[model samples]
Target: MISKTTIDRVFETARLEEVIGDFVQLKKSGANFKGLSPFTDERTPSFMVSPVKQIWKDFSSGKGGNVVAFLMEHEHFTYPEAIKYLAKKYNIEVEETERTDEQKQEADERESMYLVSEFAQRHFADMLWNSELGKAIGLTYFKERGFTPETIKKFGLGYCLDQWDGFTNAALDKGYRLSYLEKTGLTIVKPDPNNPNGTRKFDRFKGRVMFPIHSMSGRVLGFGGRILTNDKKAAKYLNSPESDIYHKSKVLYGIFYAKKAIAKEDNCFLVEGYTDVIQLHQRGLENVVSSSGTALTPEQIRLINRLTKNITVLFDGDAAGLRASLRGIDLILEQGMNVKVCTFPEGEDPDSFAKNNELEDIVGYLEGNAKDFIQFKANLLAKEAANDPIKRAETVRDIVNSIAKIPDGIKQEIYIQECAGIMNVSESVLFSTLAQIGKKESTEASKKQRQEQKAFDVVKNDATVEKVDVQYELERKIIEILLLYGNNTEKFEDLVLKESETGELVLEPESVEAKVYEKIYLDLQEDEIELANERFRTIYYKLIEALNQSENFSLSTFLGSLDQEMVSEVSSIMMEEEKYTLHNWERKDIYPKDKKIGVAQLTSETILTLRCFLIKKRMSALQGETREGTQDNRETLEEIMNYIQLNKLLNQKLNRVLS
Candidate 1:
C-alpha cells in the first residue's frame, strides 16, 4: 500500500490540468479548461477541469473526480497504479514494497499479464543493450535502419534471443510465472510427448528486435518483433497476439509518444508502420502515429478523433497492393474528419524519405504534396477509367459514395462540387447520385431504428413515469453547498418557534451569524434528520467533521483523504454549475447569479427545505401507520397533526403555501 505521505505529496505536486493535458487537449475557458470528453465520443468540449477546485467533470459521461480519479477512469488504472503513474511523472519517489512472488501470483489475471508484459519489455531492452548476440544482431539491425541511439532508446527497442525457451527460462528463474508469459503471448506452450512435463515452451519472438506497444497512458501492453535474418520459413514481423490488455486493432503503435504533439499541432499524420512514425518523429515531425498494419478500425479512428479532426494519411507509392489502403480514407470520412492523402515518390516510403531528408524538406514536401482525399481518390480512379465511359461513370459514383459517407451535409456538398469539377461531370447529376445514396442510407437507418424501437416499445408504454426526486435533489444541493461553501462564514436567518401575539404557534425569522457548515450542521442536528441516501450519509458526517476540525482547509487535501467514490461524488457536486460557466452563456447575455453573493440565502433555504421534507416524511409514515393499524390511532393522529403544523410553519417561512 502507498503511504499517506506519498499520496499527499502526489496530490499536491500533480497539477490536474497538466496531468490531464497529457491525455486530452484542453482549451482555456473562464478560469477553467474544456476539452472533448475522452470517456465519450464527442466533438464539442464537455470534459471540464477546474484547477481551483482540483477536480474534473465529464459532462457527457457524467464521470467526475480529482486527478487520480481521472486516471482511474480514463486509463483504467488501479488506485496504486494511478498514484505511481503520477509519482513517476512528477518525479516523486513512492514509498512502497515490491510485490513478492506470492503476491504476484495472487493478482488478477489481467494485472498479472500486465506485470509480465512490463517485465518482458525491460528484459528485451536489457538483452538489446547487454547480450552479445543482441548487440551483433538486434543493435546492428536498428543501427542499419538509420535509427539513432536516442531514437532507439526513446522507443524502448529491445532484442529477444534465438534459443527456444531462452526467455521462458530467464523469466522463470526471476520468479515470473509461465502462466502469465503464455497468456501475454510472449511464450508459446505446446504439448510435447518427449518432455518430462509433457509440455514445451518456446519464445514466440525468438531472435527478433522488439518494439513495445503501449497504451496512450504509457502502459506496456504488448510488443511487436521484427526478425533480422532472411529466413524463408519464418514470418518477417510478429506481434503479441490479442491478450487481455492489448488489442492490435485498437492500439496505435506510437500513440504514447505522439498524442501530445498531435493535439498541439492540431493535426495528426497517420502512417502505416512503426518505423514511419519513429523516423518521422526523429526528423521533427512528432504528430505522427501508425496503424501497425492492421486494417483501419473505427475505434482507432475515434482515438485519433479525440485529439484532432484532421488526418493526413501517408501511403507508400512503391509498395504492392496499394488500392486496398484507400478504404481507410473512407473510414476517416465516415467519422466526420477532414482527411488528406499524401503518397511518397516512387522507390521511397515514409521511413526512407525521412531518413534521407532534413526536417524542413520533409515538412515542405508533405505540405505541398498532401491532396484532399476526394481529389486524390478521383484522380487515382479517373486514370484507371481512361477511355472507358462505363468505368468513368463508375468512378464518379464511387467518389460520390465516399462523399456521401461524410456526416456533415455542407462538407458533402462542397466535396461534391469539387468532385464534379475534377470529373468534368454536371453538379446536378452528382447531387442526384448523392441524394439517392442518402435516401437509401436513411431508409436502412430508419428500418434499424424501428426494429430497435419495437423491442423497447412495450416496455416504454408500460413503464410508469417517475416524478422528480425532490429529496435527492435537496440532499444533492446540501452536499453541493457544503463542498463549495462549507468553509465560508456567512450571516444566516434562524427561524425560531415563538408564540405570536394572538397566542398561536408561529415561526419568527431572526438574524444569526455562523459559518455555512455550522448553520447546516446545527439545523440538521436540531431536527434530528439524516440524509436518506447511503452515499450522502457517509459524505455528510465526514465532511462536517473535517469542516469543524480545520480552520485552514484545502479542497485538494480534503479530497485526498476520502476514497475514490466519495471524491468523485464531491467533485461532481462541487463542479456541476461550472460546466455551464464553461459554455457560451455569457455570449447570449445570459448569466447565472454569482454563487458567492447568495451563499446565505442558498444555505438557509436548503436547510429549511430539508426540514420541511423530513417533517412530511414523518407525517407520511404516521398516516400509513393509521391506515395499517400498526399503532394507536389517537397518538398517531396527534403526532401527524403536530408534524403537519410544523411543516406548514416551516414552508410558510420559506414562502411556500401548503394546501
Candidate 2:
C-alpha cells in the first residue's frame, strides 16, 4: 500500500488542467477549458475543465472528477495505478509497504503475465545499449535508419540473439514463471517427456530486430519483429499474437512517446512503417506514429482522438500503392476527424526522404505540398475522368459519399460549395447528390442505433419504474436555497419560540432552514427509500450524513466529494443564486453592518425555498386549484406567500450585512 501522505502530495501537486491538457486539446471557454468529448464521437465541445474548481466534466458521457479520476477513466487505470501515475508525473516518491512472499505469490495469472512482459521489455532495451551483439544487430539497424542513440532508447528498439534459449534462460533464472511466458507468446514452449524436465523452449524473436509496442500509459504490450535474412520460408515481418493484455486493433505505435508532441502540434503524422516513425521523430518531427502497416481502424482513430483530431497521412509517390492507401481517408472522415494528405517524391518513402533533407526543408515541403482531402481526391480522380461523362458522374458520387461522413452540418455545406466549384458542376446538383447519400447513410445509421437501443431497453425494462415526484421539485428548490443562503443567520426570525410544559411556555433557540431539512431527512430515512434521480439521491445522503456528524457543515467540502454530474447540477443551482456579490463588506459604510447575517439566515432561506417548492409540488400532485388573483380562500397561497416573504427578508439581510 502506498502511504497516505504520498497520495495526498500527488493530488496536491498534480494540477487537473496541466495533466489533462497533455492529452486533450483544450480551448478557453469563459472560466474553464472546453474540448471535443474524448470519450465519445462529437463535433461540439462538451468536455469542460474548471481550473478554479480543480475538476473536469464530460457533459456528453457524464464522466467527471479531479485529476486522478481523469487518468483512471482515460487510461483505464485502477485507483492505485492512477496515484502512482501522478506521483511519477509530479516527481513525488511513492512509499509502499513491503509485501510478504505469500502475498507476492498471490498475483493472478494476468498480472503475472504483465510482469513478465514488462521484464522482457526492460531486458531487450538493456541489450540494445550494453550488449555487443545487440549493438551490432539492433542499434546498427536503427542507426542505419537515421535514429539517434537517444531516439533508439526512447522507442525501446532492440534485438534478440540467434542462440535459441538466451532470453528464455535469462527470464527463467530471474524467477519469471514459464507458464506466463508461454501465455504472453514471448517464449515458444513444446511438450517433451524425454528428459523428465522436458518442455523445449526458445525465444519468439530469435535473431530478429525488435520494435516495442506500447499502450497509452507507456506499458509495453507486445513486440513487432523484422527479419534480417531473405529466407523464402519465413515472413519478413512478424507481430506478437493477441494475448491477455495486448489487442492489436486498439494500440497505436509511438502513442506513449508522441502524445505530448501530438497535443502541442495539434496534428499527427500517420505513416505505414515502424522505421518511418523513428526516422521522422529523429528529424525533429516528434508528433508522428504508424499503423504498423495495418489498415486504418476505428479503434486506431479513437486512440488518436484521445490526443488530436487532425491527421496528415504520408504516402510514397507510387501511384498504384497510394491509390490503395487512399481508402484510409474515408475511415478517418467517418470518425469526424480532420485529414490532409502528402505524398513524398518518387522513389522515396518517409524513412529515406526524411534522412536526405534537413528538418526545416522537410517541414517546409510538408507545409507546401499538403492538401485537404477534397482537393487530393479531385486531383487524383479528375485526370482519370477526362471528357468521360460516365466516369465523372461516378467520381462525383464517390466524393459526395466522403463528404457525407462528416458530422458537422455547417462544414458539410461549406465543403459542398468548394467541391462544386472545383468539379465545375452547379451547386444545386452537387447538393442534391449529397442529400441522397446522406439519406442512405442516415437510414443505415438509424437501423444500427435502433438495434443497440433495443438491446439496452431489454435490460433496462427488468427494473421497476419510479415516477418523478411532484413534491420532490419543491424539496429540490429548498435544498438549493439552503445550500446558497444557509450561512446568513441574521435574516431568520431570531425571536425565541416558547413551548408550553404542562402550563407554562419556555424559550429555545431556533434554526428554521436546518430544522426543515432535518425534519424532511428524518421522515425519509424512516421510509428507507432513496430519491429516484441518482445525483439528487447522492447529494441528499451526503448532506444528511454531514448534518448528522457535526454541528457545523461546510457545503464546499460536501460538494467536492460529488462526481461530475452532481457537481454540474449542484453548481448550476449554486451559481445561479450566488453569482452577484457586493465587494468589501466592511467598507460598504452602511449602518447596522455590524449585525451581519450569520449561517442561520442563509440556511433558513435555502430551506424556505425547498419547503415552498415541495408544498407547491404536493399541491400540484393532489390536483388542487389556486384562487387566482384573490388573497382569500387561499391556504396554499398563504404558504407560498410566507416563503416569498422569508426569501425577501433573506436577500435584504444579505445586502445589509455586506453593506
Global Cα lDDT for candidate 2: 0.74
Over 4 Å off in model 2, which ranges? 105-111, 193-198, 386-389, 421-424, 445-465, 469-496, 499-602, 605-659
lDDT of each: 0.90, 0.74
Give RMSD to native, each candidate: 2.0, 9.3
Error of 1 at 130 (Å): 1.2
- TM-score of every candidate relative to the true structure: 0.96, 0.75
Q: What is the per-residue lDDT of model 1 for residues 316-433, given as tens digits with 9 covering 90 to 100?
A: 9776776688888888988889999999999999999999999999999999999999899999999999989999999998899999999998998899999989999999999999
Q: Top TM-score: which candidate number?
A: 1
Q: Give the poorly placed runs of model 1, Cα more than 4 Å off.
A: 97-106, 195-197, 578-583, 625-638
